[model samples]
Target: MSGLTVRHPHPSDHAALQGALTDWWGGMGGEAGAQQRRLLVPRLFLQHFAGTSLLVEEPEPAGTRGGAALRAFLIGFLSQTDPDTAYIHFVGVHPEAQRGGLGSALYQRFFDLVREHGRSRVRSITSPVNRNSIAYHTRMGFRIEAGDRTEDGVEVHTDYDGPGLDRVSFVREL
Candidate 1:
């Protein structure tokens, strides 16, 4: 993490982040990954909530002609309706950079940002099918919120996004 730089995302980052999501998430393959890609970071988040979002990258190789290489990102915002709460909409870590504490650093940075703004808690959601995400969040000290229903023994919010689009919810206190 020494060489990596953390900065607020700009509108220019949307396309590149989208590409990273596609590449990092490509393991799902076929329609599943495609569907997730559509729900990944949208332009409006970077445009409106850049202050609270973060982009992590390492400098391009010395001989390279491009910008830094994307390593990870977290898109989050303090809730307008619940001033004491912040919501993390999406997060991604380059596959090659996994297990190096990059994801934890992003979350820690976001927690500090929100806490500075008076937020006492943070919330996020993930598909129950993403067992890795669920496990990761749990390991990060997030408590899974009890939902209306359970699937595969995991609590989930039925129709959280819409009919049949269930999600597992997580909340962590700052």
Candidate 2:
């Protein structure tokens, strides 16, 4: 194991990031599930491209070089509702890389970035059915925000292509 480095993602890193996320989702289920996660990556890239998102990477150990695989990532932006708020859109670690603290490391990096920017809160959402995600968020100190729910009966967002999934919001004060 080598040291993990976290930083903003370059545009060229998109493909590998997408592949990792696709694998994570597929392991959780199949194409339908993977497709749902697939929608988030491009959005994350777009946010990063727009200067509103952060993408953290863990380069492969030194002396071994190619494209460094993205071990974990968090995507979101500083909030408009509260200029001091940082919202997390998504976070994940490659299944094979779990138990190495990649997820926590990614969060710490993001939290530090947010604090550096003077933000006071970090918010995020995950599907209620994703118990694992809920547990992880809770462990990281996020609290369930009231009024959070899946948009169950609402029409899918025009941009959405998968089975409609509901999500619940979580928040942590930094």
TM agreement with the true structure for every prediction: 0.95, 0.78
Best by TM-score: 1
Q: What lDDT score belongs to each candidate, Candidate 1 first?
A: 0.90, 0.69
Off by over 4 Å in 1: 29-32
Residue-level lDDT of model 1, residues 1-174, one tens digit each, is 798999999999888887887778756856777556646677999999999999998899878986898899999998999989999999989988999999999999999999999999999999999999999999999999999988888899999989877899999998
Off by over 4 Å in 2: 43-65, 148-164
Worst 10 residues of 1 by lDDT: 29-38
Instruction: Tally clashes: model 1.
Output: 0
Looking at candidate 2, the ten consecutive residues that score lowest on lDDT are 153-162
Q: Per-residue CA lDDT of candidate 2, range 1-174, in tens? A: 356666666666667767877787646767777776777778446545435454555666678875566777777677767888988877777777887877787788778878988998998877666778877888999986665233443211222223565556778998
